[model samples]
Target: MTEIPLEHVHVAPDEESGGEPAPAVFVLHGRGADEEDLLPVAAELPDELHVVSLRAPDPLQGGYTWYELDLSAGGLESSQPDADDFRRSLDLIGESVERAVDAYGLDADRLGLLGFSQGAITSLSLLLEDPDRYAWVVALHGYLAESHADLDPDGIEGKPVFVGAGAGDRVIPESRTTAAVERFETLDADVASGSFPGGHGIGPQELDAVVEFVASRTA
Candidate 1:
């Protein structure tokens, strides 16, 4: 597959990568957000993890986006993705992570994905495509994109999957976010799900859960 180039900011652990390859988490941001948007969240994660925040290939209103949503297809709550764009992004993102493993001395087996909003959607889709590639996932305020692939319970079984939702999220809808828990459960993933009392953005409680989830998996 021809991989599209991406811009990113990588934050490495304080310790050197000598005896063992460093564990890394690829951070993906929401629509209209840049790589720098989630730096704070990355900073809060375990120091042992090399945090790599990737800018979406496609530039948007002063930021970036993985794909475009066809709101006209239905509405906000039921919008459809530009299938071509989503597929291209899926391939490109996976390629980027693989390249990073070689470039930054990342442990390919210990890689994780932490994404919010559209990033969350992309993360879940990535996990479904190849569960073995990722050690764990933290998908916040996003729903599963069915167009990506068929749900494979066997492939997803026993993987650490954290599905987060904002109780008052209007952008993705609380129902949609909650639906992901069921989807992951049906796949028999070791799933941890919760809802925060907020809108489309991450709340304090959610942040704690995210940090906790990552820490547990990293150890």
Candidate 2:
């Protein structure tokens, strides 16, 4: 697992990490977006949580992407990230998680994931690969990748997951969202799903749900 370079931000409670470890959440932004893109959302989340926003490693049209989508497969079926590249990114993220734990004295059991759009897809990918590595996940306007279907469903059983999709999202069709939710449910994940009346973006209502979801997990 080679470590790929990643720019990121970490925010934790003002108090020193002398006592119990704090809860932490890794925030991932959408495709063509930078690490700072999700800072506002992180700010709105619970202050007690140690938030870390990561920048995707791959550069795109003046922005960044987790991996390149393989259009040849049709309908965003796969991302054409070389095995090494993908593994490096995943390793980088894991390194980031370890760094957060050491920095904030975070409880490994309370680590969570929050991602939007392409980030959301990556979050699911990470979670599926190592469910215990993450305590909970909030995926907004994202769908599961085909690779996820090959994973062992029992790995994620009983884990908490919040999947929020926009009903009017043209970017990700309802069918995709439906498939994502159904996949998690089939794996026996403790799924909490909602649909907002908007497009491929999060709104006030969805934010409220996100806040509540994190609060519940971090509480």
Candidate 3:
């Protein structure tokens, strides 16, 4: 667990208010994006969600990256995260979720993770490392971390997981996307995956599907 509280977290309050505790969706932005990047998508989600977006630890070219990447040999590969950085990120995200739950008075049973690209990679890493920590996971245009090999998908048994991929995603090839889906399935994650007709980014149709999936989980 993270000893220090997560700093630079961006928050968007629940759209609806009652006395009851609401669900929370922690958003993770893609590489070169800031904490506020995914707030729009979060707003489009269920109004009951307390949307919280986190800034990644590593600083890059005027933006932030959860970990370093290397595209040297033909495809994407993780370069910065060794075993330690990987564990630190998982702990940081886990503790951040806990903090958000306590601070927002959010529903622990309904906590979810949403991310794009590098953010999606982190979301998957965090979820796989501590499967019981999150209720649902949504990964868009992202892959499993190359350095992360220890997986216990049984921990996430019966949990809903959505993965969105672009058919023509040049940045992350189709093979990687297939591998991600396979890995999740191997762990027995309730996987819902879709391939859109675009590249490296979420389209309207994909977003609509994600909204429906998340709504079902949050409902």
Candidate 4:
């Protein structure tokens, strides 16, 4: 894979005096959102963990986007025109993940990825493409992109994954979420799936569950 540079901002624990190597969590925001959008969620997590939010390479109208979208279908279209671009974008993310792990002195086996919307799709793709890269993955209000069925489940065996979506999410239908959950299960991932009452947005209950899962895995 080609090397991809990342622009990141770190959030350290409030109590840490200095120079402590805390476990790190990489946060990826949804389409048209920047790294700073999800930084606040880090506060909801355990204070001991470090949070790093990454910005996507491609800049959209105002913010950033993972890949091109097919708004008509509410899904990603993988044609020749967009296929290679998407793959390369994912590769960039993978490289960024490796960099974060090394830069933060995080345990390779304890690294985590948390994403929302398009960011969630990218997160799941990375885990599926390179299984065992993250100890835990939280995909909020996102679906597995095209060609996920062809992934080798053995790669992610025993990895913990939390998938949360709103029951009325229009951007990502519940059926897509169901398919993603089933696919992760088939891949032998320790998957937990839940739905909230709102639409295409994160709620407190969902965030709490994700925080607990990350703490349990890293602790």
Candidate 5:
């Protein structure tokens, strides 16, 4: 695999190479956080799985944003203006994953996605938009985008998905999370959901559940 600069995207191989193509997990960070934020979590996973952490394309005032936010509304305003950009970013990441699979000789059927906050939302969107691409998806403290409701159920056929949310999360409401879970179930995805007593972040319990879910699918 070609080595790319760790600017807006970072891709790395596992240290313990066994001369076999390694399964991969792509980590996406929340707004304001960079690719490095999720590197430690990569280390926590099986070293046999190559990990890649990607940064958002748009730069925020202080940190970074995947796409622009529109707060001028009755609810969250996700108009076409911002939606197009978000889709482009997802496409780029998807292409990157495909490249990694071919270059590393990794099994495309074993690809996984792990994302937190904004990244989690993107991850969910990617899987929903192009369901055949991933084996499993792990979403932490993120809600499905409004556009996701229109996705065809036939796209995701029994794909494994794990969603972890904080009951008291202010950014992503519990109600929204529940709705996302229902949406995934409606699409025939094998969904596992867990909620904890916290706000807007993950805990050890959620992490454990996510790891177990991935392990089960990859096993």
Candidate 6:
């Protein structure tokens, strides 16, 4: 595996695994957020999961972002990703995950993904690009990139996918998220969805659902 190209941190498993490799969840934070932004929540997951949080490659206003957003003609709801930057990140992140699987003593068969906002968009894209790569996926407050809609979903059958967003979320728009859910369903993935009040962030109920979805697989 290649060296990890992005900065990252890890939360070790809660309990000792008797030296056996542990299942791991690779975490990605939203745009303008660092690796530490989701550390607290990633820790909330069951100790069985070894969590690795990665910082986005690009530096933004006091934070990091996975890719650049082109909002010149549209607002957040219609904003598009810089295709070149977005494509680059997809490859970068995928390579980092390969390195992580070996470096972190991660169980290759049970790898998972968790992402928020822009991070969520990237996570979903990675899963689509390689359907069998992850055991499950959790995406919050983000929408699918239109660029990835044409990918073949051949190996994604019965995949566990949880997508959540606030009904009032103006940042990504609930409609966009719902569209992602529908797309997953069309691919025959076992998708779980949640809608909460307010906008553009994870709510308490939403977080609990994410935890449960991951725990079931790890436990």
The TM-score values for the models, in the order shown, are 0.95, 0.89, 0.88, 0.88, 0.87, 0.96
Candidate 5 ranges with C-alpha deviation above 4 Å = 1-17, 75-81, 153-155
User: Across residues 43-85, which tens digit of lDDT does each residue of candidate 3 receive?
Assistant: 7888777888888887888888776655454445333344565
Between candidates 4 and 6, the lDDT winner: 6
Error of 1 at 39 (Å): 1.0
In candidate 4, the residue pairs with backbone N, CA or C atoms under 3 Å apart (3 or more residues apart, or in different chains) clash, namely: none
Q: Give the TM-score of candidate 6.
A: 0.96
Candidate 3 steric clashes: 0
lDDT of each: 0.88, 0.81, 0.79, 0.78, 0.76, 0.89
Minimum summed lDDT over a 10-residue window in model 3 is located at: 73-82
Better of 3 and 6 by TM-score: 6
Clashes of each: 0, 0, 0, 0, 0, 0
Candidate closest to the true structure, highest TM-score: 6
Q: Could you give candidate 2's per-residue lDDT for residues 17-40 as a string of tens digits?
A: 578887888999988998889888
The TM-score between candidate 3 and the true structure equals 0.88
| Global CA lDDT computed for model 5 | 0.76
Per-candidate alpha-carbon RMSD to the true structure: 2.3, 2.9, 2.9, 3.4, 2.8, 1.4
Better of 2 and 4 by TM-score: 2
Number of colliding residue pairs in model 6: 0
- Per-residue lDDT, model 4, residue 16, is 72
Stretches off by above 4 angstroms in model 4 are 1-4, 15-21, 70-81
Q: C-alpha displacement of 87 in model 4, angstroms?
A: 1.1
> Model 1 residue 94 lDDT?
91
